[model samples]
Target: MYMLVDCSNCRTPLQLPPGAKSIRCAICNAITLIAEPRAVAPPPASSYHHQQQYPPPAPWPSPYQTPGGPPPSAHGRKRALIVGISYKYSRHELKGCINDAKCMKYLLVNHFKFPESSILMLTEEETDPLRIPTKHNIRMAMYWLVQGCQQGDSLVFHYSGHGSQQRNYTGDEVDGYDETLCPLDFETQGMIVDDEINATIVRPLPRGVKLHAIIDACHSGTVLDLPFLCRMDRSGQYVWEDHRPRSGVWKGTSGGEVISFSGCDDDQTSADTSALSRVTSTGAMTYCFIQAIERGHAATYGSMLNSMRSTIRNDLGSGGGGGVVTSLITMLLTGGSLTGGFVQEPQLTACETFDVYAKPFSL
Candidate 1:
């Protein structure tokens, strides 16, 4: 006798054969565990009289099992690691990083339904020493985020802090520069380079899993070393430019999906400013990203990116009005400007190319 069950990830109905312990969903390829069948009494004649006959359940093999072997159980899980380094009492200190982490946590818990216990946060204000956003601690947290990840899992990594670029010695970087994330003790411990970041979080992902990285920092574009970068113009026309290394190195996921959103291009610097929210300083990119989602403008990836860029442009005086003059003055007073120019554009990179306008955006 076969037992009826639902796929753990896609919720597709499946029939488990006798003696089968686990089976893979034919639709989503997600592995699901099967419980032993229990005896139940048949329905009464009146109950059957009102029911229509149904087709027999489709036969799907238990890929994990052999003729007489037991199979292991697997289920998808969601996890996140959020790191915000304020570099307190230092020359490179930031005012809004910790606040960014807190806001992100709130959004994930309240909006996305990520369990509080599954989300790990590291910030300057954390009371636990292990939770401090130090170089070692951050690396370990990255490992933990993807550790034990299986097919159908969803993972996220969010960083709001200082980011920089270092000269790339390897032939992997097309522009000959590697992006980096600055930890609290970066001056002593050295910044986390893009190569290491990719190796740690991006490359190990398996098929049917997905990762979304939100980086609100300067020089963060391509920070995860994803292979394709989505280049869009002000008119919303876009193309996915190939960014694979000429050295033939693989910087993509292991059949899983990886997408990244950053504050600016590799050559530009992001602003830490109070212009976006007049009340307190915040990473401009972080502010706009949350706003895009909260305001119901993030139906697709293209829409989300466009909304973020438009908000930043208008807030920074590019839209043309008396409001522009006011924004310019406010930004100048706050010492918030991109290095080469006042422009800061958010960037998107991914392991694979897809239709940004057609693909629905989700965490």
Candidate 2:
């Protein structure tokens, strides 16, 4: 007899073929396993005739369970990929990128409770060739981050490096340019564009999964190509601007939740400076992002964003003449321009629209 089962991923009901132990859901393409019924206590004497006439339906197997599964945990599995490219020996070499990677890894392991084995780091200090932040390795690492993700999974992708833009030929970008991340070998391999980044990590995300990206790079406002970009002014009034492509391409997640916090807007460049800290130089955005979380200012998304902006603005200062000079000097040194006396406002983008104040910020 045929058996009815639900898809493991999408929960669509399907009919299992006779004698088949498993079946694949056509809608979500997830395989459902059929299990044999286990013996149970017989019904009471009063209902014995009814039980015999109609047997109880078999129970659906748990997707995460096995014949003898491991003990349950307090939370779902968490994974992260932290990449910091210093570009040693090159004119574009950065000092604080590797430090950012180390700090981020520590925060994830200590504060967020992510397993050390599950966190992947790619930086210039790594001796392992596979761990080096090359164009190919970063791509592979992105795939590894979301591989086998399931319900209740929390994933993070953090990049601290140079970012640039190329003209958008696909018409997907509203500004006619594609944001890009500069890998260590980007000079030779070409920069990894935002389209590819979205396809790799953003598109395949299934429902019930959450991805948060921290991008401390130039022109990274929409690095992940999320559909809604939050436009908030100093007054704290905000509106969600729709950025859907006119090409009819879908940039939103596949029922999953994705939120990105970037260093600056698409037209602006992020700062790499020693001004924010006396101990070491770091990406302005990364420093403030960590500070907001560690210092207990991140109760909600709106609060965290406001805190980051306030810190950056106060530390960098603001003046018309000084801002122009700072921008010129920054361009000469880093090959990018800054705005408002080295001010780099953090931006928030997401796959869907929600009230930032109401949604509590979590890993």
Candidate 3:
């Protein structure tokens, strides 16, 4: 007996004999199986087991679960890697970067309750050869952050150092510039570009895990290559824009969550030794962020953003502190604004703006 069938892989029509086990399509040169139905229904646009455009369904509900749905739970784990490069003798050295990383580690451990051992620190003063914030160390540390990450895991990647922009040769960046983080060996090994950063941290993550990147550097907006940049009005509404039109930048939420906060716009620079405060020195943005988080106030994305912005404008004056960074979360009861108005902006890049039933921000 003979039968007519279409190739499942290439979708080409073929003439076949009964009991044929497999066939090869001539047009697309794809092999397809002729077998009994294993799946009850056709998969969606993509399969969870395989990689595709939109990520596959996650195994658990995310932080901001839909209302009345199952509550968000921590089934995986939490880890962090904080890198602060002083670049001691380098021409691009700064004073406040190491301070920023240490302070953030304090906040995570004392306040947010992150495990001390789970936190990795890479700085210039490290005696261990492996802990130095060189290009190789930073890259390895990034892998360590997301390695073995599973659903409900929370991870933080904080970088405080010299950030610069290079001419975009790869077309992955939309603004014709590729943001870079200068490691201690940047002069020799070259700066780590945004593309490499994304491929390292964002692409490998599975759904349900959350990554929060607090990038306190120059030209850091969209540094992680997150797909959606969230814009919020002074009132309460928000709109998300594609970070790049032609680029297929990876979003962490394929089966996990990724939200990156950058210190400034791609064309602008973040301040290091700000003249605003009485302290020795600190990244302007990092200082304000620490202050806000330390307040122990219940923080949502909106509330935290306003608190940081407001604290800076009030104490530092306009442009006194060049620290303004933004992040993305699913949803919470965040509805507040900075009192003093300024054009100083921070950028928030999310995966899909999944703002339905998320909870308040925590560690």
Candidate 4:
């Protein structure tokens, strides 16, 4: 005497045993109660059973909500982890890196609908005490990137700090040496090398995930006065230095897919204070690069970098400041190829009749 039930909402059919009192739909995840004709529970003697069959209240929205609501399509969202090192203790100046990161985060989240949980931020005050070998706050970020990153996910690594170089290790081939990122607690006794960064975050990333690294420091063969151009393995040692590269371009042997955006060139100093009101700025190049992207002028990475270089040169009143903006961005595309999508797609307003997607940077 099994009772057969069918869901009216999703139209999925279900089977309930004679004694079964309730059943849930398999398609829409909705619940339905099964009542045997003779086994129906009577309402209170004075109450009407029709009142108990009232409709349910509407459900709330999911965490992943878009401008109108949940996206009409089931598209994998743009996931990102942004880190800005604006304030440092022993490290070099990073006046605007953190601010730049914050702005970039806002663009990605609000404009692109990237989940708030997906974005990670690190400042001078936040540090992971347990992970001593790596940068203070970077360890948590690395942990999340390594474990959570999936194929097809896009990752953005933005750092506004000092960059240096060291003689290539015996087995290393490219560039005859390697570039390094100076962590917050980097000690002169044992410099933190870029290899560690690669090992922790870059190397472990899942396949099909697009990796973009923006470095707003110097790191050519030689920085201002410090000879980062040619040096021995000083990974564990730290030297208080200035004029280092902010970013570099490289890939893993297994075809590591990565693109980097550098702030300045190797020999020049990346300006922290801007000419625009001297109102502290964040990763100079990073800020401008994002501005172009958010504006929708950069349909590709190459276009975005070109726009950044032009804008920076115009804004700062100089063409070459030794920042690594172009080099880092070009590296992401493997020596220049278009990548990056138009974040916002235009739609007519409730009262308007024209397409605003063509409008200048709708997002």
Number of the top candidate by lDDT? 1
TM-score between model 2 and native: 0.74
| Steric collisions counted per model | 0, 0, 10, 31
- 186-288 per-residue lDDT for model 4 (tens digits): 5533344555555445544444555656566655222112212211111212222222323322223122244455655443445553323424545556656
Q: Ten residues in a row with the worst lDDT in model 4?
A: 343-352
Residues 281-333, candidate 3: write the lDDT tens digits.
Answer: 56766766776675643367666666655655664444443333222100111
lDDT of 1 by residue, 232-308 (tens): 99999999999899977778876779999999999998876543333445677876787788778899999999988
RMSD of each: 16.5, 14.3, 14.4, 21.4
Best by TM-score: 2
Per-model TM-score versus the true fold: 0.73, 0.74, 0.70, 0.53
In model 1, which regions exceed 4 Å deviation? 1-74, 275-279, 316-342
lDDT, model 3, position 102: 81
List candidate 4 stretches off by more than 4 Å: 1-77, 88-91, 125-136, 171-175, 188-191, 220-256, 265-269, 275-278, 318-363
| Candidate 3: C-alpha RMSD after superposition | 14.4
After superposition, candidate 3 runs with Cα above 4 Å error = 1-74, 233-237, 247-253, 273-279, 296-298, 318-344, 355-359
Per-residue alpha-carbon lDDT of candidate 2 for residues 12-122, written as tens digits (9 for 90 to 100): 335566788897654344678885432222122233112111111112122223246575453477888899998889999886787678778878887898867668889
Clashing residue pairs in candidate 3 are 64-357, 64-358, 206-255, 206-256, 207-255, 207-256, 208-255, 208-256, 253-256, 285-323
